[model samples]
Target: MSVNALISNYFTTGALSDLPSDHFIDGVFVPSERGNRMESFDPGTATVFGDFAAGTAADVDHAVSSASAGFALWRDTPPARRCAILMEAARLMRAEADWLAVVESLDSGKTLTEAYGDIHGSARLFEYYAGAADKLDGRSVNLGNDNAAFTLREPVGVTAHIVPWNYPTSTLVRGIAPALAGGCSAVVKPAETTPYTALMIAELLIRAGVPAGVVNVVTGTGQEAGAPLVQDPRVRHVTFTGSVATGVGVMQAVAPNVTGLTLELGGKSPLVAFADADAEAVAEGALWAIFSNAGQICSAGSRLVIHRDLHAPVLELLVKKAKALTLGHGLRNTDMGAVNSERHLAAITAHVEHARSRGVEILCGGQATSDPETGKGWFFEPTILDGLSAQDPAIQQEIFGPVLGVQVFEDEEEALALANGTEFALAAGVYTKDIATALRMARRIDAGQVTVNDYWAGGIELPFGGNRKSGFGREKGLEGIDAYTRAKAITLAV
Candidate 1:
């Protein structure tokens, strides 16, 4: 679709067009509370996608109350039935892949390639969880002759989910799949900049035999809808995927309630290229690792710790490759795309500016502009920074854009130290030929997951998560189910 066409059609998007007439509650799509409450935007183009009646505190209360009312029925709902619904949801996701991809690309400033990958990944997550839905099991234990014991995993009831704008479609499903598979109902609050995809899911899940109240979305401010969603005593769990600060704030809201939490937060993950590695592949993978999806990933390899010997060559190649990346409208074929939101653009620009003011080298890109031939949109050069200490704010902090900070390391230990310096322990990469060193670095790196000799480092089944300030609990794997549930032990007299 052409830029003009997409813009023209944006206003006609009806994901939430009938919200006032169709409320999602208790397995039915009925009228939402009477109001023209909130609007959604296409962050890439700065256009209003559509509006929905913003769900109020009362609305949240209604959803949770409805979910709570359905818990016993849903939890006792045979696991096979739960699996079937999720399986159907996956089918619907596959059917709507194109639409969701377009919606994601429109809402987030990601290339169509990135957006397609996100929607595909979301479908895969739901499918994976569907395959595992009926696999939730308990174990019987023998307590020496006289006593018997067993353990069962039970759903934590209604869950509150909040997503960040970076990977809106994918993250929502990433949280939603496991919650549904565990027999828990979810009330999701998508990032304000990109809520349409959530509405898209609500639409599909409703069509896929999901009980309406089982998956409700309320679009509003975090303080308004988000806080209550988490604080509602009826909500037994809170799963948030966003920045460290926002994740912390949400946790604080649920603290008094002690809601179960699986907070997937941010990272300043590192990529270490030792001297023995393939220069070209590492350079390309390094660029892709960090700048993929314009470096908006929570596990973006934003820090580079290259060996002293290979630093110059690798740096030169990376600079050339990053500069060669074409940025423009996400719909058109481009190696890179625009910043997802203006706020994100500002955050990226601010980080780069602060780094430059403090004397860190501005290796490339810290500006935004438009292509006249095409419609106006946000674009940034894939940026790199050097000549800064490890503590330099540019290298230490997350810019959350297509910005990479280069810091050379004398040897393995220094590389590991520089990588571990950030409060985020989400992901790290080690490029080396020495198995001994790789194993040693693996033990030393302070991250939950480390990629060696490659940059294909994220997904649904890989137990993706972080430590320290990167937030806690795991997602995208069997552990995600564990994260969403509590283990119950039963014992008998010996």
Candidate 2:
């Protein structure tokens, strides 16, 4: 069916039909023990579309217990059998990519195209981990003739995954795929606003031969559901992706148990352009860096630091392109889409307004808007603010919106300083033809991942994470699987 037809059939009068409203636990949908429900809004229209279980401490405990039991069974299951199950899950994900993309767009207010890519990435994550499942081989150490030594990789037991709202399916799968591949069963707590896709993914895993209780989903507010899951001692490992404040909270909650943790917090990453760089390529790269997904990405290149000689032309190009971006419903496949919710729209507005009050130049848009046709969505204009100092709040803080801050630098040293000014060291981008300059910046930049010519150059195979206040540990690629595993060294006399 066409995309419009599917939307019309499922979403009528601001209410969705056949939505997954209950938590998926023990391979079945179950109501929360508290019997509470929270309404989820359609950010495109700013109206209620569905409600999901308001998970509480009791619900979290139940899910964790189920995961613990499943871990016992799954960890003992042969690696080959586990590999087959994960491969089948990836196949199911591919078969339902279209439907899953639609659901993701509805829940997260991202463009249909971006949502489609997210679904594809999600499937690829499962596929990648599946390929690595049976290959987690231990290495033997060469010792004296009468002595023998080897190492073993083992699952860290039941794990808790606290998924953020933005990039719901992608982030959820990014963490859990490796956990499952490493033989750990998981209890997931999806952001309340975007829980539908998490539940749906769990259901798909169950259908793909993941045994009962191997994957569970609980949806609710962070304070109630997330804290409990993180604090649960039965959960031996925790994977969380969100704000630095919350990531800190996760660390505190896990402190008593000393549980293993992996955190991918947010970033105010930079896109540095040199005077010798191709202006056209830099403009295009800058556009995709900051505005893709309406600039809600943790790795979004929100700060543009360019040489003084090239700033004006690049700024003009960026303003022209940013002004022309179309915004509306995600299903409409516009150039941009709504910011996740009304609250988020307000936050973006506040940041822009604060910058403007400080006499910063508002090069283009600086106001909140709505869907031009329906006039109801929580939308914000693509914004560009200039004349900001290195310590400006707009430059240092993670606005988590489509607002780009521009700064000019005179030379390579100044550019490097500005790019690495913020507490976030998640990701950065460098655009220059000079190989030596690119190599120097790549080595000196504090970010975990630095792309030389492109803002987001790598794929699912690359390792991704952050440093300093942006949180620690890595996700994606082989390093991702390592987070879910514990290493044990063995020695013996033969």
Candidate 3:
């Protein structure tokens, strides 16, 4: 789509029938300086969804400069007015919800339900932060003599965000939502593979009355554009959501500037099913645990620990459910879908192979299926592995696929220990009817989000983050809104 048409459709809310091969800079869609391009493949058909200008370091600098320049005015744009703009953006997002889903499914192998839900979820974030925009008030502090003191929540100028490909559209929204709400300007470097949705989102932001340079997106390889953006001194804050390794590297890259950091990184979240829990509900939750988005979520329930007394029956039901899923494209109303990319499929397969070598027992389907109707798509069987201890390699690492490693425990002490065995502390669940047990585990579990007799995680209105090695800082909820702001104190005396 040409710039003219894109802007025209920005108001018309047409289908995502046209994709412009460009990066967004200074609120305008433009071609990349580096003529090199990257092609996004549709996981459903292994077809080219679109090609985008592969951004370079210079492009990152250009975006950062524009955002920084824009910040001088945007940061001071009264909170009430900023809220109006973001609220408009949220409304615009809802208006184009169908188009957003289509673009997301094409660019990211997202299921219809997930792609559409992501758009809705993202819109909620905008709406939520929009309301909180003007609510960012500083409280007064009492002091001796005739003195007045208080604090102000100010925007950390020129923030740079590096969002992951798995949930690019939403993750970028996670950062951009609060930045815009907090009256800050941002330069976003979206994942190279899934740049289309980001471009489309930038268009919505512009239509919502966001001024030029308030938000810009540059896409490229992480080693170049992502790293440079993080390292840039002008970026007062850096927000990233990806792997632990990448987050560590980004931390080191941004260390020189004392930049504010918010990282929503990887996870090996545990799902524990106690004997007292409802068997049917537990089995169904386990299915949702590792199969949603083909288990692309960082907080996915990849590890399932069941009580030994009920393990056999639960395992039988789980295996049966796992094998019965229908694998196809994300567009249809199917039980399952293709993996996101060739690289992700390869990694999932490698993890399964590694588990098999480590004397793990495969309880069900553990291989990939290439159905032509799905277009040589990368669909993997939802796998369950028994004969694995908490210390098993599969249990200790984040496979980020549909591979669930089951570990049996005799007591609550063992369950908690096993759940916390991995370095990741992103998310975990305890399924138990006993309120005491649920409360105990909720307090003891080394995870950011803990649920009782349920599989609740990832919501725009909830605070999501991790403890220990799972990375730091919160995204979503009020903390997420505050994460984009820097609190400053001011004092006055007569």
In order, the Cα lDDT scores of the candidates are 0.79, 0.91, 0.84
lDDT of 2 by residue, 38-116 (tens): 9998899998888999999999988988998899999998988889998898899889887888889999999999999
Query: Worst ten-residue run, lDDT, model 3?
Result: 6-15
TM-score, one value per model: 0.93, 0.99, 0.95
Query: Model 2's lDDT to the true fold?
Result: 0.91
Instruction: Give the runs in model 1 whose Cα sits over 4 Å from its true position.
Output: 1-23, 28-36
> Model 1, 441: alpha-carbon shift in Å?
1.1
Candidate 2 ranges with C-alpha deviation above 4 Å: 10-12
- The numbered model that scores best in lDDT is 2
As for model 3, its CA RMSD to the true structure in angstroms is 3.8
lDDT of 3 by residue, 1-494 (tens): 44345434532442345675687999888777868788777777676756778888889888988998889989888889888988899899888887777677657766777887889889888999999999998889888768899998888788888888788788989888988888888888888778888888887888998889989988878887888899999999899898998899989988999998988888999899888988888888898888888888999999998889768878888898998887776665367667878888999999999877877899997897764463477888888998587778898888998889899999999988988899999999989999999999989999989876668654677889998778899988888877678789999976
* Ranking of all predicted structures according to TM-score, beginning with the best and ending with the worst: 2, 3, 1
Arranged by lDDT with the best first, the candidates are 2, 3, 1
User: TM-score: which candidate is best?
Assistant: 2
